[model samples]
Target: MISKDKPAALILIDIQKGFDNIEYWGGERNNPNAEENASAILKLWRENEFPIFHIQHCSSNPNSLLNENNEGNEFKEEVKPLAGEIVIKKNVNSAFIGTDLKQQLDAAKIETLVILGLTTDHCVSTTTRMAGNYGYETFLVSDATATFNKKGVDGQDFSAQLIHETALASLNGEFATVITTDFLKQNLL
Candidate 1:
């Protein structure tokens, strides 16, 4: 449980339409209710007037679904940033790599970060790892992130659920504390 006395920020990473393209991201995904969970957290953060940072991934690859010119580059309605909220755009997996996200968090005096978003094994994991390395207390909402199937180096196929679980497990104790959205709401509120 997080203490309400500490300042925290919600960092939503790459919750965009591009992730809806299952063909591009591989086959089926895990956590069908991920967007709903993200929405719930976003709503709670907004209602409490907590800082929220929306990370947008703009792929530099022209063939990528997340290309800046593509409609898929747009944010999903569920987690779109409202006016006055911060929106950081990046072409890399880690939001802090080429963006001012860290500086902004520092300036805002954010002691803790609640992170959730698309593709549990990708941007979400990368950002969480970086956040932990940068010395911020990070919480990853398990149900609020999803990932699609992937092919291993030996051509073995991996299920989306397996990938998601593995990613979360890798980050659980090292990068962030893995918690459910329900748990977060119950503890924070």
Candidate 2:
């Protein structure tokens, strides 16, 4: 059960269409069900009338898939931001950087955060770390976030699932409680 003592906010980070360009994003991404899972959680949050923030990555790289001018910059159809919901635009990994996210969350008196998004090793991880350091009790939905594969310095190839799992492992306990989408929906709904 959620505590009424402290408010909670749902942050859907950078789940943009640009990420669909698999080859452009290092290819073979993990967690194919991330968007659907996120949408389920989003529905639950909306039904509960909890605070929700949709983070859009406005990439500075003009050629990037998520560049402001590109269609990929748009949020996915499944989890699009509804009217009156908070939408924060960020160009960097951390949503709090150069954005009024912290101020908005503070103004809403939010003390607990439920974060889920694309690219688990990057923006999602960075934002979760900051949220924890900022003293927010954060829960990261493991099945609702994912990442693409990366080539090592020695030219070794790593799978996206490996990266996703490692990223979650690093954040769990230290920064946020890493749980599945089912776990979150079961508890919250």
Candidate 3:
């Protein structure tokens, strides 16, 4: 359980619309379900008045799926940021890289971060590890992040469910404290 007195921030990573389109990941991206989880987290955070931050991925090349004006590059409707919420754009996996996230955290006196979003293995995991390196106590909501599996060297394609489970095991309490939405809600409130 986390102490409510400690300053905490909700870090939302790459919950962009691009994942919704099957063509982007060759039908491997877990879309609709991932967005739903993100929405729940966002709603809870907003209701509790916790600090919330959003990260947007921007690709330098216009040909990239995350390029500016691409439909997939925008935040999904289910968990769009409200007025006055901080939204930071980055080209890298970690939200803090080349963004005002660090400064915002510093200004808000945030000591801990609770992260949830799309693509668990890539953006979520990388950002969680970097959050630890940045000296912030990090908690990863395991059920809220998803990653699609890829073709293996053994000629087997992995399932997104398997990837998500593996990431939960790998990230629990090392880079971040792994918790579920129910557990977090019980502890937070």
For model 3, the superposed segments whose C-alpha errors exceed 4 Å read 1-4, 29-32
Model 2: lDDT of residue 166: 95
lDDT of 3 by residue, 1-189 (tens): 345577479999988877776555645655346667778878877877888999888877787777767877888898888999988999988888888898889888888899989778888988898898888888998778877767678978887777777877887878889987778877865
Give the whole-model CA lDDT for all candidates, comma-separated: 0.92, 0.93, 0.81
lDDT of 2 at 137: 91
Which residue pairs collide in model 1, if any? none
**How far is each candidate from the true structure, as Cα RMSD in Å?**
1.0, 1.1, 1.9
Residue-level lDDT tens digits of model 2 in 29-52: 999999999999898888878889
Task: Record all residue pairs in model 2 with backbone atoms less than 3 Å apart, i.e. clashing.
Answer: none
Off by over 4 Å in 2: 1-5
lDDT digits (tens) for residues 12-70 of candidate 1: 99999989988788878999999999999999888878889999999999988899999
Return the TM-score for each candidate structure.
0.97, 0.97, 0.91
Give candidate 2's TM-score: 0.97
Model 2 RMSD vs true structure: 1.1
Ranking by TM-score: 1, 2, 3
Q: List candidate 1 stretches off by more than 4 Å.
A: 1-4
